[model samples]
Target: MIENIISALFFLAGISLSLYSVFMRYVMGGSQSWATEIFTMMLVWAIFIGFSTALRDDKHVSIDILYDRVGPGMKKVCELVTLIFGIAFSLFFIWTGIDMVSTAYAQEIRTIDAGFPIWINYLIMPIAGVLLFIRFVEKAYRFFLKKEIPTEKEAGSEWQL
Candidate 1:
């Protein structure tokens, strides 16, 4: 239920921000700096939040050639290795994101337009990092526990390309 809500929020926000960007470019007469800044921050938030959803559903992109050719046991080992790498990457992102947000907060920098606090934009990194971390843990747990895990098929089956 919580996952559903988060997914919906990310989806809506992403769509709205994207539309705003388009509007700023076409509809708005002048190139408003604030619009771009806000849109960029929202875009980052949307991407990270969407990535969290992807993590939950095991929808992250990967090269499946080796897995397809190799036997199931080898594939399992590869999966384990990939999981370890993913966890490490996520931890690194979290640490860096925290450091970045901290610096931004301490500096109290604001955007050139509208005097928007830059820290608000920087906040997205840490927030997304935490969300990604949680999603990775949840995925790891489900993988090991032999529980039913969400997949791209379940979460994004409607998408056709």
Candidate 2:
């Protein structure tokens, strides 16, 4: 819930500011490059945060063509494979994100226009990585240890939430 609020704030601010930027550039015969930079940063934060939300909600994209045809054992196999890949991807994101944030901080980097700390923008990467890692592990526990699986509705979206 909190994550959703934060992400939405960033997203809405980005959209609003970008529109303002456009208005300033064309309508007002001026430019606000700083606004552009800020909005870009905000949108990036929103996107990375929302990425983890999708995973937690089981709304991440899955083909499931083969998975749909498989039996219970095969379905488990597919899920295990997906979870492994998801975990690996999350680890990679975490490592790369840390390296990016550290290097930017060490260099005292700032945005080209807005002058905001570059590391601040990079922070969401590792945060999202951790979120994804935790969610994937939780799914693994539910499926393997608890012997649970998502129902059809949980696995699929039939309508708006």
Candidate 3:
């Protein structure tokens, strides 16, 4: 719940910064170079954070043609396969992301306009990957132990409480 709120706030801040940048450029006839760069960094963070949120809510794009036609037993099999694939994919990102962020930090990389440490933006990749991995684990547990899978509605309603 707290993570979701943080993600939302991050997204809102990005949007606000972008709009302010545009207003400064067009309406005020002035350039705010740092504003755009900062907004870009914020956008990167928001997108990475959004990936886990979407995965948790089952909002990620998926084709259900075969899944819909399968029986309950087959559905379970498919669910397992899907979970395995998701876990593997997320792990790959986590591994690569850590290396990328480390390299950026070691090199003392900085953004062009804001001069902020580039590793800060890259850090989101590994963080989001871990979040995604955790969500996959939860789904796998529910499927195996409870023989239940979350429906789209149930997934979306997780934050309602």
Candidate 4:
């Protein structure tokens, strides 16, 4: 619940900052490059932060064709397989992204736009990936416990309460 709130706040901050940047761009006749750069940075944070919510709610996109064709038992198996694969993939991303961030930090790289540090942008992929990875683990735990997995709607409602 607290994680959701934090993510929401991060997203709201991103939106607000982006809008302000856009307004400044239009109204000021010659916008500051940092405005756009900072806004872009905030966008990365927003995406990564919001990703956990998406995972928690099962709002991530996937093709349901096979899901529809499979029997109940098969569907469960498929879901388990997919979940395992997802965790592995996310772990790979997390590992690689962390390495990249560390490399960028050591190099002290900066983006061309507004001289923003490169590590900041690269950091999101892993942080978001880790959050998503955690969510996947949570799902797997639920599956093993024989608990009814919450659909996106139910997960969203769980937060409302």
Candidate 5:
């Protein structure tokens, strides 16, 4: 619920800001360079947050062609393999996010439009990366160990693609 709220707020705010940018740029016959920068940041943050929510809800896109044909045990194996991949991807994301944030911070970069430290924008990367990691771990745990996410607890029921 909280995740939904945060993502929705970011998404809505980004769209609103973008629309305002368009109105100000075309209708007012002037440019709002800062609008684009700010909206882009908001949109990016919303997207990253959405990724976490999707994983938690088992709503991420999938190709179930191979999974659909597998037997029960094979299905378990497949799920485990996919879980491993998810874990790997999350770790990689976290590592790269951290690297990006650190590099930007060390260089003392700043955003042209917002005038805030550029690192502030990049900071969301590692933070969202951590959130993604936690979401991945939670889904894996619920499916394989705790089985708390209903379909995850039920054998051969998860529809992840």
Candidate 6:
């Protein structure tokens, strides 16, 4: 819930910044050069944070044809496989993201308009990767060890005609 709130705030901030930038450029007849870069940074942070929030809520997109057709045991196996894939990919993302950020920091790279350190912008990659990794671990524990099953409420209510 907290993650969702933070992600929403970042998303709204990005939209607000974009709208303000447009207003300044058109209505005010000029715009601060840093506005676009700041907006872009906000958008990047929002996207990565949103990814983690979605994973935490089990809202990530997936095709469930096979999962729906499978038995309970098979479904559990499928979920385990999916979680393994997610963990592996997230670890890779974290590793590479750290390397990229380190390189940027070492080179003293800065943003074009604001001259802010580029590494700060790239920082979200690792943060999101860590969040995703932790979420996947939590899910795997609940699914395998806890023997928990998704309730109808969690799955969503079905329509009765």
Which number leads on lDDT?
2
For candidate 6, list the clashing residue pairs, or say none. none
Against the reference, the lDDT scores of all candidates come to 0.73, 0.87, 0.86, 0.82, 0.82, 0.84
Compute the lDDT of residue 57 as modeled in candidate 6: 63
Model 6 ranges off by over 4 Å: 147-161
Tell me which of candidates 3 and 4 scores higher on lDDT.
3
| Model 1 lowest lDDT segment of ten | 1-10
For residues 1-161, write the lDDT of model 3, one tens digit per residue: 65677788888998999999899999999999999888887778877888877877778899999889989999878888999999998899899899999999999999988899999888988998998898898888887797566665775698586
Query: Model 5, poorest ten-residue lDDT window?
Result: 151-160
> How many angstroms is residue 73 displaced in model 6 relative to the true structure, after the best TM-score fit?
2.7
User: Model 2: runs farther than 4 Å from truth?
Assistant: 147-161
Tens-digit per-residue lDDT, 1-161, candidate 2? 57778999999999999999999999999999899888988999999999877877767787877788889888778878889998999999999999999999999999888889999989988999998898888888887786665554665564437
Q: Which run of 10 residues does model 6 get worst, by summed lDDT?
A: 152-161
RMSD of each: 4.8, 4.1, 2.6, 2.5, 5.5, 5.2
| TM-score of each model, paired residue for residue | 0.78, 0.87, 0.88, 0.84, 0.86, 0.86
TM-score for predicted model 3 compared with the true structure: 0.88
Per-residue error at 76 for model 3, in Å? Answer: 1.5
Please give the RMSD of candidate 3 to the true structure: 2.6
lDDT of 6 by residue, 90-152 (tens): 999899889989999999999999999999999988988998998888788887687554543
Cα error of candidate 4 at position 143, Å: 1.0
Better of 1 and 2 by TM-score: 2
**Which portions of model 5 show Cα errors greater than 4 Å?**
146-148, 151-161
